[model samples]
Each structure stands twice: as C-alpha cells, then as structure tokens.
Target: MSITVYPARRILTMNPSQPEATHIAVDGDRVLAVGEVDTMPRGDGCVWDERFADKVIMPGFVEGHSHALEGAMWDYLYLGYFPRHDADGKQWSGLKSVEQVQERLREHAACLPAGEPLIAWGFDPVYFEGTRLTRRELDEAVCDRPLVVMHASFHVMTVNTPMLERAGILDGPRVEGIMCDEQGIPSGELQEMAAMFVVFDALGHNLFEKVSSPHVLRRYGAIAAAAGVTTITDLYNPMSDEAIDAMVEVTRSVDYPVRLVPAMGVLQWSAEEGIARLQAALPRSHERLHFGLAKLMTDGSIQGYTARLKWPGYHDGHANGLWNAAPEVLTELVQAYHQAGLQLHIHTNGDEAVELMLDAIDQALTLWPRADHRHTLQHCQVIDHAQLRRAARLGVCLNMFANHLYYWGDIHYQRTLGPSRCQRLEPLASARRLSIPVAIHSDAPVTPLGPLFTAWCAVNRRTASGRQLGEHEAVSVGEALEMITLGAAWTLGLDDKIGSLDVGKYADMAVLDQDPLQVAPAELRDIKVHATVLGGRVHGGD
Candidate 1:
C-alpha cells in the first residue's frame, strides 16, 4: 500500500518519546512514522497529504464511559435544563419550569395516536425549586394513555396515574424503589431499576432492545464523529445475540465513523450465565466492534437522591439512598467475574457505594490473584481521599463523572452533599496524586457527549451557577487533556492500540482548528473539531 504523509501545523503525539511532531506517515490503517517529513521513511509511492496543514492533530478522543442510548434518546422528547443538540445536529431548547414540562408533554401527547404511550427523558427536578413533577401533573397532560418521564440521571422516573395503575404498582407489594405519598398511596415516582423495570414491562418498551437497532447504532456513530471521538463505549449493554449482530452489521460499514466498545450489562443475568454469554460473544469481536468487557451497577445517581452515601446522608434530611444490587449480590458478582478473568466496569456513584465496591474488589483479588485487572469504578462522583488510596492499592481505575461539576455542581453543593462533601465531588487531582489510573466522561444523555467540554469541566471545576465547587480538586489543562485521551484509553484497556499518535498504532486522530494546549482553559470547550480521522480515513472536515 502507498504511504500517505499528512503534514499539519502541529501534532500533539501523546507518545513520550517524540511528544511533538510536524508530520505523520500513515500506511493503510496504521501509523508508519511520526516525525518531520524528512526523518520519516520515504518510498516510491509516498504521497504528501496537506489537507490538515493549518490544523492541529492529536490522538482521537476515547470516551471511556457513555451509552448508545444517547442516540436513541433523541427519538424521544427532550426536557432537560440545558439546551442540547441531537445526533442530526438539531438544537432543542430546555424547559425551565414544571408548568413548561407539562405543557410540552401535552403538546407531544396531542400528536401521538390514541392509547399510545408517551415517553420523555432528561427531566430533572433539581432545576425547578420548590416544585416536583407528580403523577397528577402528568395525568393532566395525558390521562388516557401511559406517560413516563425519565430523569436526567436515568436513575429515577415518574409516571402518570394511568400508567402506574396499568403497571399494578398501586396494588403491588411494597418495593424499596417505589415512593409513596403521605396517604400511603403509590406516588408514581419510581426510584431505581427494580421499580423502573415494572413500568418498563408494562409499557412493553424494552429500551435495551431498541438500542440495538441499526438506526440507533448509526446515529451513535454520527454523534461520536461530530464530537471528534474515534472510539466510544456503549458502557453497559445487554449482549443479546440480536444486539451483537446489529452492532457488527452497522460498524462493518465503512461509512460508520467511530469504533465501538460495548461492555455486557451483567446484572440482567446470573453471574454464571453472564460469564458464559460474554465468553460466547468474544469470538464475534470485530475491528470496529469490540467485546470482552462487563458492567455492574451497584448504586444509583447522587443528583436523583438515589445513590447510597456514607454516614450523614442527604443534606436536607431526606432518606438514605438505594442500591441496585444488594451488598452480598454485588460481592458475589465481583468474585465471579474476577475469577473469570474479565475486566469489570462497575458503577458506584456514592461514597458508601465506592467503599463497598473497593471492598468487593479487594476480596475478589484476594480470592483470585490476577495482575492488571483494571477493574474500574464509573461515575465515582462522591469518592473521598481514603477511597482513592484503596482504589490505587487495588489496581483499580477511576472514571470520574467530571461533567457532574458543570451540570449538577450547585445542586450537589447546596442540597445533596452540602458544602464540605460537594467540594470534592469528582476529586480528579487527588486520584492522579495517588498514581491511580483516572479518566473523565460525559455520560451522555445524562449530561452530553463532548470530551473537550468534559475536560474543561475537570480543568475548571466550575458549575452552571458559575461557582467553583472544588478549586483544589481541579487539574491542569495538560492533565485534563490526558485524562480524556490516554488516561481514558487506559481505563478501557486500549492504551496500546489507539490512545496516542505513535508509530505502530492505528492512525486515529482528531483534527482541530486550534491547539488545545495553546488555548485558555475556558476556551478549551470552544475549540472546533475540524475533522476526525479513523484508521487513516477522514470523516468530517471543512
């Protein structure tokens, strides 16, 4: 194959041997050399491609934690606090009040066919002060059909009275996740997966099944490409044969711009079944679609008041949070997966949950001695210094929800965790100081999918209200950039193949209009993504 020498204004190769370069030579899908044009090997068919001569090139971003639902979510009504753009590049305005939310629901309800269920997502009650969305309010929008609104956290959801009645929640046995009104009636609010599963069954809309469709997969690739990401994780997926087939079919197409790394959602099945399923699916792994990672959900979301915290719980004296998996169950799953030699990506949002996971990992490691396990804690928003030390000692990675500082920092500081606890929400700097492998994520559809924006949140710990939640926990721009790129790659166990622009690695890079390292910390998110080169094939550019 002919060698293509792509010259650029500058290349920020994360490789330490030659950190900066002016040109990179690509042979097929792999990088042949990264240096000045003269120093690179030349052949008879070598061609100099100066398409990005004025652009800065860096390793394409690796989104360590995100979901394919980000694409499927655009199909539903968006009721988030912040305005967002969909996969098709259409911008949707944010709803400011409960009244506005109801109004939008009413509008959407009128357009739908009679008796058809209405499902909306990204509804956050925190943004609305002194008010909450109740079933009665949702009934006023569409009393005849089922209406369910998913919270921004995706941890809790509210349903209309008709839907609650349809799901038999009102007459069902008392469940921990089902909230009750003052009169001991089902309040229409479902807290965690258990309660939500009942509603999902009644609605007959299995979201995981829908996410595997080719259309959703294509949209996910488009969204990732638009953000200059070359590799993204569908973090938690039900690895059904049909889902796997859809992923393979969609990703095998050359037009699909991003590579996918899907981790099996192990909680849906028994530990033995999950291990068996993962083992069976390993043989089907493709270049664009990777398998062999597993996910476990221990607790819920902090913003939704469903995450299990340590000692003094919620600031306003609300009840303690709930766990998706009981402590014993989580420990059993951890031990089984560890013994099976699978890298686990466990979700633990609260301090208590973090502690539980650390203990479980420790026990699992003690039972089965494995090296470089790289078991990671995702959305570890409320972990403290002591937990960081334990995580480092256990060889565990921490993928902090850095985007939380921007989206829900004020709420965390003022209501959920109070001032002192909220100050160290993500604590990226502390994790780095302990020499723990660390990464930051957007957790899309919860926040939004943009690593540059996520990096900026880590660099400047500033919330939507312009408050610096934790100045001490903030990391430098260089550190933040590394967290999004190489650090994230490390968490996913793909550091050797794609994190940096090094020789012998895949030629996957993000072409930028401005240098991220040269810009002001505040300007990092504003930097334009000119194009993304995946395996040497450019996707989008001017």
Candidate 2:
C-alpha cells in the first residue's frame, strides 16, 4: 500500500503519547505514524504532501448530542435569534423581534410555490416581550396557505389557523401538551413530540423518514464537515430499518464525510421490542454507522418551562415541568436496555429528572453489574455537583448542554431558575474537579453546531446578555478544548478509533487557520475551520 505523508505547521493530537507532530503518515485510511517530516520512514512509493504546511491540524471535533435533522431542516425557513449560515455558505440574518419573524416567514412563503405550506424551524419566542406567539399573528403573514412553525426548544410548535383547519385538529381533545386559550380552544402552540406529531405528520413531511434517503444523509454529512465535525451522534434517530440501511449505505459511500452514531429512540418501541430490535441489528452495524444504542427522553426543555426541576420549582411560579416518561417507565426501560447490553443515552435536563435517571441507572447496575456501561446522561443541564458525584460513582458520563450558557443563560437567570440555580448551571469545572468524564455539545438547530463556540461558552461562561453567569465554574481553554475533542469521543465510545491522531487510528483531523490554544479565550469561536480530513481525505478545503 502507498503511504502518504501530510505535513502541517503544527498537529495537536489529543493523544498523550505524542501530543504534537509536524507530519502525519497515512497508510490507506489509517494513520501509519505521526512524527516530524525528517523522522518519518523513507520507502519506495511514499508520497510527501505539503499542501497544509501552514495550517494547524487537530483531531476533528466530536458532538455527542446533536442531530442529523439539522441537515434536512435548512429546507425550511430559520427564524432564530442568532445569525446562521447554511451548508452552501448563505447567511441567514437573526430575527430578534416577532415582527421580523413574521416578515421573514411572509417573504419565504411568497417565494415558494403559491399555497404550499410555509414550514419553518428555530422559532424561539422565549425572549419576546409579549406572550407566546399565537395563531392570530401568524395569520397576518399569509392566511391562504398553511404554516407549521417549530419552536427552538423542539418541544413545541405553533401552527396557523389554515394549517390547523387543514389538519382538522381544531376540535382535538384538550390534552396535556396541546396548549389551549382562555375559552378552552386549541391555541396555535403544540407542545412535546406527542402533541407536535399531530401537525408534523399532517404536513406530509417525515424528517426521520427523509433520513432514509442517501441524498439527505450526504447533505447532512456535508453540513457536519463544514462545522469541523468528524464524528457525531444522531442522538435520537428513530432508527427504522430503512433509515438504518440508508445510513449504512451513505457511510459506505466514498463521498461520506462524517461518522454517524445513531441511538434508536426507545419511545418508538416497547422495552422488550427495543431490546430485541437492537440485538438483531448488532451484527449489521457498518464501519461508519455505529449502532447498539438507545435514547430515552427523561424530561423536557428547561427554557420552554417544561423541564422537571426539584423543589422551589420555577422562579416565575409556573407549575413544575412535565415528565417526558413516567419515573417508573424510565427506570424499567433503563434496566431492560442495560441488561440487553445496548448503551443508553438518557435525556435529562432538570435536576429532578437527573436524580431520577441516576437512580434508575444505579438500579440497572444492581441487576447487570457491568463495570463500564458508559450510558450517558444527555443534557443534564441543571445537575448539581452532588448528583454529578453520584453519577460518576454509577459510571454515567455527561454530555452537558454547554451552549445553553450562551444562548439561554440570561433568560434562565432572569425568567426561569433565578440567579442562584442559573449560576450553577452546567457545572463544567466541578465535573472536571470530581474526575467525571464530561463533554459539551451545541445540540444544533437548537443552537449552532460549532464546537469552538461551545468550548468558548464553557471557558467564558458568558451569555448573550453579556453577563458571566458562572464565574467560579469556568474551565481553562485547554480543558475546554479536550471537552470538544477527546472528551466528546469518550462519550460516543469512539475514543480508540478517532479521538486522537495516533498510530493505527483512522486519520481524521480538522484543519484550522490558527491554533485555538494560542488564541484569546473569547476568540476561540472566531477561529475558522478551513477544512477537515476524514480517513485521509480532505473536505471543505480553502
């Protein structure tokens, strides 16, 4: 096999054995060695490439809690508070007010074929001055065509009257998640998956089903590649047979860009059924499509006022949030998946819910006694150091919602949890101090998928409002970098294969214009991802 040596100004391998190198030699798709140019082995058919000589290469970022859905959703309009850039590099300006949001929707709707549904995502009215967005305001945009607007939290959706009538859900029963107005009529807001599914399916769009197509998955990989991400978890893909097959096919394709680790949603099946399905698919997992995992949403979003917090609940005095799955149901499901040997990723946002899931994992351990389950607690946002300690003892790693500190920190401090609890959110430093394995993620589409920005958020703990929420809990820049790279890989159980640019590992690296460690802490997010190399192939090159 021909060996190619790619030289760079500096290579920051997360590996401890040889942390820094000037060149990486790859044999086929695997790294043969990482060393200085002069030190590399000289042999016939060896190729020395100096194209990235001035670039700084590091292990590509791993995002443990983001979704592939971000790829396909760009087809819809984005009305987020933060400015975003699409895969094609087109910039979408932020919509700060409800008026801008309405105008943006109206403009997108007009451009579309007349009378088609104006579907949009990333619409969070959490910071808006008035009440939650209503159907009335949306009607002013376009009364003729139907509209489906998904909330940023991904827990709720606001629909216009045309869409509601088209779906014939105007007379639907008064349910827990179906938000109602003063007269007990269905408001435009639909909360949670169960409630949102009514309109999501009605629109004739199944994002998870669309994921079964190779075209969609390839586009998703392109988006991930642009973000400097090499390995990412779909986190909660429905994992249908067709979808899994598509993922395997895409990963096997020569053009595939990122490694996909999909955790099938447990809510899609009974405990027994989920275990059986996972067991059957264990042998079919592809090199790029890693499987044998399950996802359980233990509680809802904290900002949407739907996360289950402990006592002295909401600062606004709203009722405590909803339970995504009953305490008993989550516990029983955890035990079954644990005994079945499938890694479980539990979505726990509130502290109360974190405690519940921790207890459930402990219960599962009692039955199975596996030393290294590594079943993660995704978005354990409001967890305390004590619960984190408990989680550490129980061998549960945390993929904390670090991006929350920037996007929703101020709102959480002022509107939801009050100052004390908000200041304690994420607890990155405390987790590091206690020797707990922790990683941070952007949970893209909810926020943007930039690991550098996520790292900056952890290091600075600054909010959009420009206040430092958790001054005492800020981690150092180097520590923050690890959280996005090796730390994230550990959470995904792919550390040995891709976290470091070590010998025998896949040659995956992110090319940067500058080294993040040498830059200012606040400027970390400003560092550009020039390109990324996956298994020795360059993508998104300048």
Candidate 3:
C-alpha cells in the first residue's frame, strides 16, 4: 500500500507519548507514524500531502452529545435568539422578538407547498423575559395549515390551532408536558417528548424519522466537516431498520466526512426489545458507522422549566419540573442495559435527575459488577460536587452542556437555578478535581455544533449578556480542548481508535489556521478551521 505523509506547520497530536509533531505518515486510513518528516516511516511509494503545510492540526474533534436532527432541522426555518450558520455555511440571522418570530413563520409558511405543515425550530422563550409563544400567536402566523415551532431546547414545542385539532391534543389525555390555559384550554405549548409525539403523529412526520434519510445524514456530515469535527454522535436515534441501512450506505462512502455514532434510543422500546435490537445491530458496526451505544432519557430541559430538580426548585417558586422517565423506569432500564453489557448515555439535566441516575447506576454496577462501563450522563447542567463524587465512584462519565453557559447562563442565574446553583452549572473544574472522566458538548441544534465555541464557553464561562457565570468552575484552555477531543472520545468509548494521532489509530485530524494553545482564551472561538482530515481524506480545505 502507498503511504501518505501530511506535513503541517505544527501538530497537536493529543497523544502524550509524542505530544507534538511536524508531520504525520498515514498507511491507508490509519496512522503509521507521527513525527518530524525525517523521523517518520519511509517507504518507496511514499507520497507527501502538503495541503495542510501552513496549518496546525489536532485530533479531529469528537462531539459526544448531539443529534442528527441538527441536519433535518435546517430544512425548516430557524428561529433562534443567536445567529447560526446552516450546513452550507449560510448564516441565518437571529430573530429578536416574538413579533419577528411570527413574521418569519408567516413568510416561511407562505412559501411551503399547499397543505404541508410549517415547521420551525430553535425558538427559546427565556430570552423574551417571560413571553411564551402560544398557539394563538402561531394561528396568526399560519392558521390554514398545521404549524409547529420547536423550542431551542427541543424539549418543548408550540403549535397552531390547526395542529392542536389535527393532533387531537385539545382533548388528549392530561399529561405533565401538555400546557393548558387558565380555563383549561389547550395552549398549544407541548413540553417534552410524549406531548410532542402527539403533534408529530398528527402531522404524519416524525423528526427522528426525517433525520434518518441519506440526504439529511450527508448534510449532517457536511455540518461536522465545516466545524472540523471528524467524529460526532447522533446521541439519540430511533434506530429503525431503514435508518440503520441508510446510515450504513451513507457512511460507507469515501466522501462521507465524519464517523457517525447513532446511539439507540431506549425510550423507543422495552428494555428487552432495545437490548435485542442493539445486540443484532452490533455486528453491522463499521469504521465509520458505529452502533451499540444506548441512550436513555430521564428528564426534560431546565430552561423549559421541565427538568426535575431537587429541593428549592426553580428560584422564582415555579413548581418542580417533569420527568421523561419515572425514577422506577430509569432504574429498570439502567439495570437491564447494564446487565446486557451495553454502554449508555443517559440524559439528566437537573440535580434531582442526576441524583436519581447516580443511584440507578450504583445499583446496576453493584448487581452486574462490570468493569469500564463508561456509562455517561448527558447534559449534566445542574449537578453538584456531591453528585460529582458519586459519579466518580460509579465510574460514570459526564458530557456537560457547556454551551448552556453562553446561551442560558443569565436566565439560569436570574430565574431557573438562582445564583448559587447557576454558578455550579456544568462545573468542569469541579469534575476534574474529583477525577471524574468528563466531556463538554454543544447539544447542537440546541446551541450550535462547534467544539471550539463549546471549549470557549468552558474556558471563559461567559453568558450572552456578558456575565461571568462561574470563574471558580472555569477550566483552562488546555483542559477545555481535551474535553472537546479525547475527553469526548473517551465518553463515547472511541478513545483507543480515533482520539489522537497515535500509531495504529485512525488518521483523523482538524486543520486550523491557528493553534488553539497559542491564542488568547477569548479569541479561541475566532480561530478559523481551514479543513478536517477524516481517516486520511482531506475535506473542506481551500
């Protein structure tokens, strides 16, 4: 086989054995050696790839917690508070007020095919200072068709009267997530999955199902490639046979930009059913399409006031939040999945949820006694040091929603969590002190899918309103970088294969215009990604 040597101005290998390198030699899709060109393995048919000669290269970033829905959501109108870039690198300006949001919806609705539903996403009510989007407002946007607006959290959604009537939500069974007005009229604000599923069923479209398409998956890859991400997880997948087949077909292609890890959503099946499905799918796993990772949902979003929190819940004296899965259900799933020997990524956004999951993990480990389980807690935004200690003892990794600091830190400080708890949100430094294996994430489509920006959030701990959230909980730039790369890979159990430029590992790398270590902490996110090299294939370079 022919060898290819990629010469770079500098390479941050992330492999401590040889921490830095000026060149990397690749044999096929795996790293042969990484060092100075003279020290690299020499071969008769060696080829020098100098595309990244003036750039700095690091291990391709691994996003431990994100969804393929990110790609699918772009097909709809974006209504986020912060300006965002789509897959094709087009910037969609942020909508500032409810009037602007409704106006955009009206405009987008007019352009949609007749009788088709109008779907919009990334709408956050917290930024509006207590102004909630109602079905009445949505009706004004597009009363004739079924219109739905998904919140930035994806934990809540608001629909027009047409959608509510079509979904039969007005007369639907009373549930924790179904919001009703004072006179018991359905408000069109559906909180969490169960309530949202009603609208999805009525609309004859499932967002998760929509994300399984080859086109959407490819778009997802493009988004990752643009962000210099080589490995990213679609953290919760329904895992239909068609979805699996589509992913296999897409990732098998040489042009596919990133390794896709789609965790089977346990919520979609009984414990036995999920286990059987995952066991059957495990054999289909490949170099680019990974399977066997399981995802469990325990609670809702804190920003939506739907996350289950412990005592002194919601600083403004709002009632306690909702649970996606009851405590008993969580315990049952944890025990079953753990016994089945599958790694789990459980979503626990609040402190109470964190405590419950920790207990469940403790029980499962005691019963099964498996070593190196690496079951991770996703979106662990409100965990305390005590919970961190328990997580450390249980060997549970944390994939923190660090981007929350930038997006909702001010709101959390003022309303949801109060000052004391908000200060402790996504405490990476605290997790490091306790030696708990940890990673930080964008939870993209909730925030955006840029690891550098996520790292910047952890390093700077700055809110959108310019508030310093938690200086004591802030981690250094080096530590934050690890959280996005190897640390994230470790959480996903892909560390050995692709986290760094170690010999025998996949030759995956992100080429940058500047070294993150050399930049100011505040300017870290500003550093441009020139390209990404996935398994030795260069993508998105000039």
The true-versus-predicted C-alpha distance at residue 317 of model 3, in Å, is: 1.3
Q: Candidate 3, TM-score vs. the true structure?
A: 0.98
Instruction: Rate residue 56 of model 3 by lDDT.
Output: 98
Candidate 1 stretches greater than 4 Å from native: none
Assess each prediction's global lDDT (C-alpha) against the native. 0.90, 0.85, 0.90
Error of 2 at 432 (Å): 1.0
lDDT tens digits, residues 451-475, model 3?
A: 9999999999999989998799999
Report clash pairs, candidate 1: none
What TM-score would every model get versus the actual structure?
Answer: 0.98, 0.97, 0.98
Query: What is the C-alpha local distance difference test score of candidate 2?
Result: 0.85
Ranking by TM-score: 1, 3, 2
TM-score, candidate number 1: 0.98
| Each prediction's RMSD to truth | 1.1, 1.5, 1.2
Clashing pairs in 2: none
Candidate 3 regions off by >4 Å? none
Candidate 3: global Cα-lDDT?
A: 0.90
